[model samples]
Every structure is written in C-alpha cells, then in structure tokens.
Target: MSLLFCEVISAQQSLPKIHKDEVDFVNPLIGTAITGFAKGLDGGGTMPCVNVPFAMTNFVAQTGESKMGRMCYQYEDKAVIGLLATHQPTVWMGDYGYVSIMPQTGSLRVLPKERRLTYDHKDEIAKPYYYSVKLKADAKTSIKAEIAGANTCGMFRFTFPAAEKAHLIIQGINLNPELTDWANDYKSRLKRLKGYVHIDTVNNEITGYNPDRQSAQLGPELKNFKGYFIIKFDKQIRKYGTWDNKIIKKGSEEQFGTRMGAFISFKTLANTQIKVAVATSFISLDQARSNLKKEIPDWDFEKIVKDTRNNWQQQLKVAQVNGVTNEQKTIFYTALFHTLLFPRQFSEYGRYYSAFDDKIHNGESYNDYSLWDTFRALHPLLILTQPERINGMVKSLLQMYQEGGWMPMWPNPTYTNIMISTHADAVVADAYVKGFRGYSTKLAYDAMHKDAFEAPDGDMQKKWGDRDLWTSYEARGGLTYYHKLGFVPVDKVRESVSRTIEYGIDDYCVAQVAKSLGKTEDYNELMKWSANYKNVYNPATGFMAPKNVNGQWSAKPDSGFTEGTKWTYTFGAMQDIPGMISLMGGEKPFADKLKHNFNDGHYRADNEPGHHYIYLFNYCGMPWKAQELVRQHTGWQNFRNAPIGINGNDDCGQTSAWYIFSTMGFYPVTPASGLYSIGAPQFPYIALNLQNGNKLVIKAIDLSAQNKYVKEVRFDGQLIKNHIISHEQISHGGTLEFKMTSVPQKD
Candidate 1:
C-alpha cells in the first residue's frame, strides 16, 4: 500500500470477521490451566458449559480445588439428593450459598445430622449437558444429574447388596459448614443428618421466601417422590409448578448407598418425562413455551445439548484468531464462555418472574439481564451475533421500566433497586443507535430519563447521590486549583476519585443517548458534563490525578481511584479520547505517554478500566504500541494456575474477557457503544461465527514471541494501515491479517 493510501486506510473505518462454521477455533479452556486464587471452586476454573449463557443447570467440577481454594461439589456423593435451585454470584463474589441435596439408604429418616458422600475419580461422567456420579459403594448405587434452568433432574440407578439394614436418609438443608466438612472430614457427619425437601414448587418464589416453606410438608413416613405444597396469593394469579423427589432404597449402611430422582417440572407440562423451561414474565408462559417447544420441545436431550453447543459455537465465532496454542484457544473461548453466563435465562416455559414488579407476570421477556457486568461487553457481543436476544433484552428493559418505574441499574428478581451509576441510558442509546428494534424507542428513552432522574437504591444511593450536582461541581473547568482549591476533601471518603470517574461515564452515557434521540439541548448539556473528565487531568504526572477540596493535586497519590491509581485511571476517558489526547499535547507525545504508561507497571490488566487502553494507541496513530502491549501481556501472563496471577480482580471475567479478545487480536473498545477496535493478534489463526451469518477470521503473519509487533496489516487480503475494527464488519465476516516485526515498524 502507498503511504497516502495507508494514511487514508488508517483514517477510514476497518473491521474484522469470523466464519459461520469455525468450531475448531473455539477452545473454551484457555485460561483455566492456571486458575490462581480461583483454585478449587473459587477461582472459577471449570469446563465450559457448552450451552446458552447460564443454560446448563451446573458447571462441571474438576478433580481438585480451584485456585481460590475451595473444593467443587461432585454429583456422586455417598447418596443421591436433589439439585439446588439457587447459587451464589459467579466471579466477583464468593460462595454465599451452598444449598445441597442428598439421598441416603438403609432407613427412611430426615438424616438429623450431616453425612459424608464419597466418590472415586473414575465414577463420574460429564458432558456439556449431562453429568453423572457413582458414589462410594460396592455395587448398585449410581447418581446422574443434569440441568434444565428452574430445575435440576437427577436419575439414580441402584443395585442392592441385600443387607437387611438398608435405608434412605433425606438431608434437606445444606449449609456452608456442611459443604466444608463434606470436602474434608467426610466420615464425621455420616450418621445424624437432619433435613427434608420443601416438596412445594408453588410455594417457591425467587423474590420472597416463606419460613414455612423450609419445613417438610410430608410426615416422617415419606415414601418415594410423593410430596406437595400450596402457594399463597393476595390478588394476582401466577403460573405455578410442582417439585418431587423419588428414590428406591434398600439394605442400610451395611456398606450400601441409595439412588434418587429429583425433579422440578413446570405446570405447563403434564408429561412425567419433564422438560425444564424458564420465562421472563408471568403473562407469557405460553410464549416461553412456544420458544421452548419451537426451539427444543422434543425429549431428545442430546439434540438440545448439540443445539446449545451450536449456539455457543456461533456466538464464540464472532471473533476467532487462529494459529495459537491449545492453551490460548481455551482461554479465548472460556472468556467468551464467561461473557455468556449472565443475563441468564429466566423465561421458564414461556413465563418468568419479573424484575419490575414483585409478581409473576407473563410476557416475551428474557429475565436474567444482569446489566451490571453485561452492559460492558456481553450485550455488545450479543448485538454482533445474537441480535435476536438483544431485541428481547431491550424489550425486557422497557417492560421493566414500565412496570417497576425505571430501567434497572442493577436488577434482581423483583426490583430495579439501583446499584452503581444509571448507565442503562448508555445501553439503550447504543442499542437504539445500533438499530436494535425489539423495544419501543420512545418508551426506552422515557425509561432512560426516568432512571437518570432517580438515585440508585441501596449503598449506591448512599454513596453517590445527586448525579447532576456532582457533575456540575466537577465540570467547573479548573479542577486542580478548585482542589488546592478545597472542593473535594481527602479523609475517610475514599469515594472522591471514584465518584468523579463514575460521573464522567454517566455524563458520557447521557450525552450519547441524548444525541442518539436527537435531543440537541439535552445532548449539549450532557456533552459539557461528558468533558468533566478534564477536571482530573494532571499535566505534571500526565495522568488523571485526583485533587482535594482546595483545588491542589493530592499529595499522597497512592491508588487514587477505587481499585486503581491515577496513571491507570488517566487513560479511561473513552467518551472523549480526542480531548484526552489533546490534553496530552499531540499524537507523538500521547503515543509516547501511552507506551510509557503501559511499561510503568501501573496498568492493572485484571481490572476493567485499563482493559482496552492498549487499543487506545491505535487512536493516537501509534497502533504498533497497542500491538506490542497486547502480545507482551498475553505472553508474560501465566494463563493457568496462581491466585495473584490475575492482573486484578476478575470483576466477573471482564479482565479475562478482555484478554480472551485481545489475544484473538481485537476488542469491543467501547463496550456500551458496540465498537471493537483492532489490535495485534497473539495467535497465528482465529475465526468467529456471527449470528448474522458471517464470520470474523484473523491470521497472524510470521508470528512468534520475538515477532510480536505488527509489521504490516491487511483486511481480506487488501493491504491496510488502519488498526481499528468495527462491530458491523466483524459480524458480517472477513479475515484480518497482521505481519509481525522483530523491531518497531516505525517507518
């Protein structure tokens, strides 16, 4: 390419692509090999659940503890019990809940104490959708389990040793202590276990719990899976269901275990061979069922698993970078896998519990939209391939607003109880601008406005109240002087810098949404607010230095932002990078600054804010800088095993997700806006299958540890100089090639 053409190409739009059937490109276990603090169950290093995001009822447990030091649960405990309906937060939070169910043999009792369930390594079977475990038994007892959303169905097949002392002990309540004991002193709690099944599906609600629901409705002499309960209601009638446990036991602890069948079947289905379904609302059980029946109504479990795996294959296909090692493939696909975990599926059998109202409603909605982490990348990832789900998510957000009074900031089952900044406006605005038409634009706009007007609920509200005033105060133009200048004070209030950074994002989001909707006045107002990032700039340090109420830079500048420092926080002005660049003087110095920043050991790669900063070099006419950093980070890090090995907090896989994409050679640079800028590919070959029936393929040229920097670039075999890629081009399909260099390709 000529220099002029290269200049133009660099200035013009550029994007990448993945193929439709490039299944081999996806290896959902890249980063798991070195799961550090995530060791055991905590580090979250497990096999990919080849299904919809959170589609599988359970993730497979490896043989040992995760790097986080917790032993994962196994299906083949001493006895077969029920599969739990609740779980704790995935990445950021630890195991807050450890609900377990187990069945016993020898006697019909509640197992008044805890018991040890042991299993051999060879007795377990795990696939994408199926899992089974053979407990520690001589012969005859085997427990198999699989997930179908709202329910976990387990089938136990057992043979008896013909002992007169056979019995079945049902342990109902599972606690943290119990799980710890089960992982360690398994022999200690084998006798006096005390628990029973609630036996009531109708009595179960995601939002509310009845104390009585904990007690067994069945008397002590319970037999098989025969148990029942009633749902109490005030006015609104909702679709209900039933739960039952059935197990045939024999020959007590005279060296014997029992088998059990646990199921949670929806009311819409009369078939005993149950199909598990979930809905996002109460009014649309039929719609959910229609979805289920149309998509997967037949009892072919294998087909369903295949279909689910295909779904993941297609989604992960959005950005495939090839010619990498097996470990790279695993990390890449696994990161993609983690991204799909949440906004989980709540639309069971065409009906779902609503986040807007504390009631069971029905509508064609996707319930598990966790905007907290998803708004960053998952939703954008979906928009590129699974636009259909994006439509559903948009409509769900709108309905949530209509029924609950505002768009959810951090939604749970029945409340949009706000947590964090009201960034829904950014998501809606981006979706609308991106041409996602699943929901009403006007309604969405109104919801965004409503969400902006209110304070988020809980600790978020108490921490960051009055968004407008905060923005105004911060945007007054001379932040440093205003601080030497006595505006923000330093004390126990560690929230000062964080609040500023957050307000900047909010302002940018509001501006983007307003501009998209053609509200010029609102747009102008928010644009000024968006520029509030200027207040934190420190020319001396060339970072977004924090200041005190006196308008002077904080003297004690040690980790100013919540989890990052001034240098790390400085480059986070995504909303107005040009402004940030201008603040650094010009492109040359700006590029130099970025290069310097990257090598300073200040960039927290494990944290979210610093994730895409490597790509920022491309915007500054120094794309090679991004290439070097990308390759270096991928190469230097131990992709598997180690606790502090993570660059920062997992932040629900955001950092890992970033690594997954970067190693593949691109990223959704502006997550809320659905834009992926190109970078250097760490691998020699990669491909992604987009839901839009297109593929994104990336192949590195002369790639190696020494040849990390990009020597040249091409899109679809055409020579190119531009380093950035767009969302549209990636989803549509094409190959991106990067020629490597032993030294800087400065020419």
Candidate 2:
C-alpha cells in the first residue's frame, strides 16, 4: 500500500512519462543542503518547503540542530526528527511558532533525540506543494508520511504497520529535548518551553500555542507574539498521554511547559492510514480552526496535493523558457520557486496579528522581509514577475510604519533590526516607479522619509553594530553624522563604509519617491545627500575606507566594511556610478578595480553585497566583461542542478533572483531607477509574461558555449546603447534581441 509520489514535481533523475509542466522542472532539493556561511559549497540556506506561494506557513522535515548548525533540514542528514509546520523564512533566521509531528509504531518517546527515525534521500520527494518520505521507525517497523498544504493548513497522511498500534507524537515547543537539566530543574525547564498544548480525547483533536521567537535574542521582544495551532484527526483516538522532563503521564490531556508535548494512539488494521489536518495562525486558536475548516474540511489527502500543484503550475506559467537544457530549466524553475517563498503572507484569512503593535488588526499584512538582501534583486524582480504582490507588499510596509512607527529594516515578522539600512524605501519606490500605486504613495513617502531623515532614539550614545539588540530602532544609524559630516565616522557606528554606501542608495530611492510626489525641495535635498558616499572614498588609497571621528581615514584598506572586504563597498555607490567612475580616475581604472576583485578573489557570489558587481561592468564602456561574467556565473560554474546549487543564503530568494535576472540578460543595478543593466542571455529564447498583460520576449541568436559574448543588442529593432533598458520600454512588451558571437564586438 505504497503512496504514489506525483511525477510533476519529482526529481529530475528519471521521467516516467513526457511531463510538459513547468513545475516538473522544479527540484526543491537543490538548495536544501545549504550552510550558514558564504565560503561553503552549500550556503544558500534554502529548505525544500511544501507550501503555496508566499504562504503564511510551510512544512519541512526537521533535523533537530543535530546536523547543520542552525537549519531545520539539510539534504545530507541521515535522520529527521519529524515533519514540522514552520514559519522559518530562511536558514539563518529563527523559526517561530513551529510544531512537529512524527508517527511511531512502538513505545512513545517524547524527546526528539530518542524518537528520531532514519531515512534515505532516495525515499524522499520535496516540491513546492508536497513532500513525502518513508522513515524506518525501527529496524523491524517502518512508516510512510505524505504532506500537502494550502496557504496555512497542512495535511499529513501516515500509513502504519498493523501489529504495533499507531501513535502520533506532537512536539509543541522549540526546546532541546536532550537538555541535561530537565531532571534537576523542572521549573527552569518550564520557563523555557514558552509553549502550551492540549488534547481532547472525545473530539479527537489537539490545540496549542507557541510564542517563542528565537530571533528576539538580538532584537526587541514582543510579549504578544504567539503561534496558534489546531489539529484534527480523521481516526479516533483510543488512548492519549503527555510528557515533560522524562516523565510520561499516560492519560494526561494537557501540558504547559517547555520540552513538553502530547501523544495519541489509535487502533488500526494492516496498512491502515490516518490523516492529521493541522492549521496555524498568528491570531488565535479560533482562527487556526477557521483556516483548517476553510482549507481542509475533508479527510482526502490527495485533494490538497492536487489543488496545490495546480496552483503552482498556474503560478509558474508566468515565465517560460525554451531552447534550454533540462538541467538549466530545473535550475531556473527551482530558483523561480525560491523567489516566491518569502515576504510571506502575515495576514490570516482577513485578520493579522502584528508583532510591531502587539495587537490584532484587520488588514493585509506581509513580513519576514530580508530587506537588506531582497531590496537589491528579490524585490526588484517581484516588481516585474510578481506584480500582483507589489501593492500588498507596499501596503504591508506602510502598515508596519503606522503600527511600529517606522518601516522595519529586517522584519522578522517584527522589527529585528538584524541588517543595515532602510532598504524598504527601495522596495516601495521601485514598485511605485514601476507604475504600481495601489498603496498610498503619500504614506510610502512618509515611511521612506522617516527612514531617511529620522535618527533613532540614541544615534550618538553608542556604536550601533549589526547585533546591538533593540536600542530603540536603529533606523539609519549614524544618520546624524551623515548629515553633519557627509560620511559616517567609524567611531560613531560599525560598518561605516557599507553604511555610507547603502544609505546613499536608500537616499537615491527616497529621492525618487520624492520626485514622483513633486516634493522638489526634499528631492533636491536627497539627491545631494545621495552623493554622500563620495565622502568615504580615500582617493589616495583607492578604497572606501572608514573615517574616524577626527576625519582621519583608517590605515587598513579593508577596515569598516560589512560582511566583506573594503573592495566590496568600494564601487557600491550605485546611485552615482558615473561620479564613482570619475572618482576612480576613469572608466579604465574603475573597470580595473572591479576586475581586481574578480581576479584577486574579493568578489563574492555567495553573498548579496557583491552580487551586483558583475553587472556594474555594464555601467562602464566594456559590457563585454559583464557579458562573459554573466555566462560564467549563471551557468554550471555557480548555479548547478545539484544539492549545492546556490553558493549563498538565498536571503529569501535574493540569490535566486540574481540568477533569474542575470540569465534573462538584465538586472536592476539601481533599485529606484527604472533601468535594467543588460548582460548576456543564457537561453537562446526567453519570454516573460509581464504583469501588464504583455509578453517581453528576449532572443539570443547564435547563443552557445562557443558564442558566450553579446556582439550587439537591440530593442524593437532599434540598436541599444550603453547596455541598459528602461521599464517603460520593456514593460509594454516587445522583442529585445541580442546578437551573440565567440569574440567580443568592439561596438
């Protein structure tokens, strides 16, 4: 009685039939083995999630931190704790309001370390909509679990072996079950669980709430933040129990402690199946039940899988690529699938629980914005490919502004202040500049203005480093210094070099919003401030070195950079690249400095800061260098059809978005700017089903391994110059063709 795994989203190893669906090309396993750092082969911190696009929740298999440092699941893990209902946006981020379930055939073990089951990679299937695995519960017994889901509800169907009696263990907390103090310090243990669970035998149901947000360690703690879950079983519960601190209560119905959970057993026949429908909500238990009733009112498991797959198919059909290899197609769709996973829907049904205000609000909401990383490419890509989400995303930002008093730099569903800058300004301005005004432009401008101008409560009291933790809200740290001195002093804030560069970019974005709103005074002011990055440039040293409070440059060239060397932020002043070129002496010196990073191994594809550096070559006269680098990065060299596909944190799809744009022969080097810096197209022919009901077709004639450089480019039969295209020109939908040749064309 083996369940059939759907071939439409199956691995690319073998095709049982001719599958023409674009979802068929997606292989979620490609990025599951990601590591936490950029130097590793698998640093893209992506999970093989099963959920609808931009879902409120996704289902994944948990590795219990016994494997990868902080990831829930890695492709190479020999065993998994259980299937988890999680809101973890990426590998580096903490998973909040999560729970796990595992089916067993023997005596119940409450601890994840005790009940872990071994499984082979061959026995697993992961897709955007569904995931299934066969686990060896013991050497003598085995169980199969199939998971499918809607936006917030997930259904797990388990097939059990007949003789041993079926049992389901529910993990309601995020504590390390193997902690040594559970025996000696029960009270301390209870305080740590931060979760509660209840069992109702008569109704065959379980309900609980977990309010723990692990990321709050480095940010403001929200007292009202909680994740509620409602679970219903199709099969009757013959027996039930709860566990805490190694003590098992065979009939207890509820528990309110850490490392605590409940288990239920059912009488079953050989090869009998049991279905558990679980619903989650940040609002309340009632809302969780409501979501469950709306999404999974029936016991049929395959119905959920079918509906979700159809949803993904329709979602992916927005972009189609022809004349590419199956491997390339798999990588492309997998990257596409990754891009749609984040800026998750924070609203449940019609209501949302705001961590910012600590209140329930009736409005649209979206969060888990990795703004520092995403504002570069992910948000820009969504501005085009996922136009439907643009307004809602902007509205969500405005909502955060109204509730939290400002837009979050990194909203871990709330303001974590994890990353730097106010790049939400870029997200808002990019959407508006793309002609999407569904949200209030005035409100967006205010938020951007607040981000740009308003200093945090204590802007000068202390250096606000990356992990300084909830010191009011470090919106534009050292902003006061920037206003007075043009460049932030390293003594005033950490990572001053990058801060100046990023703040300058955000200034450009805010200025764009201001210009659109006819705020000429603010626009002129911001446009001037946008060039503030020039102050950090040490012309004698040829690096954007940090400046001390005394206005002396750092002796070390690589000092004061964020997550990279000084070379990383040297050319990061994208708002004024032409000025940056002149500052670097000329295009040749600027190009040479850019080339030095690539040649000397300072350019990082594993991180977001330099992801745009290759495209910057297009800004100079020698786009030929950019074209070849595009092929090298987008092809088998970096993005591959393997577990280590992406070499960096997908950063909620920023890494993947880079692939999509680079392979499509364009990129948004500057966010608020409507232009896409041109690069070489990977595919011979590509088509984007734009949001404006038109198709933008790109053709790369004579494209092959031998012909990797673009000889010339054209738009609507007009020869393109300076290697750029505007949104107004491309969004209306016309052919942008490229003539490819083995040798670089001087023109």
Question: Which one is best on lDDT?
Answer: 2
Global lDDT scores for all candidate models: 0.48, 0.83
Question: Can you give the lDDT of residue 448 in candidate 1?
Answer: 67
After superposition, which runs of candidate 2 have C-alpha atoms over 4 Å from their true positions? 1-17, 35-42, 66-69, 177-193
TM-score of each candidate structure, all chains considered together:
0.69, 0.95
lDDT string, candidate 1, 608-661, tens digits:
567678889888887767777776676535344222334433444455556667
Q: Write the per-residue lDDT of candidate 2 for residues 1-747, one digit (tens) a residue.
A: 101112112323543347578898899888776543344444667888788899999988886642113578887788878888998887656778888898887777768878888998889888878888889977876788889989999999898877555689998875653432211122333464468889987778999998766565555667778899988888887689888758788889889876678899776676788888989999999899889888888887888999999999988888888765576779999999999888999998789998889999998899999998999899988877888888999999999999999999888778876678998899898888889989888898989999888888889886887765456888898999988899888877888889988999999999998987889999999999999988998888898899997899866667678888887788888778899999999988999999999989888887888888998887778788898788777766567677877776788899999999998999999888998899989887889999759999999997766687898899999998778899999889999999999998656
Number of backbone-clashing residue pairs for each candidate, in the order shown? 117, 3
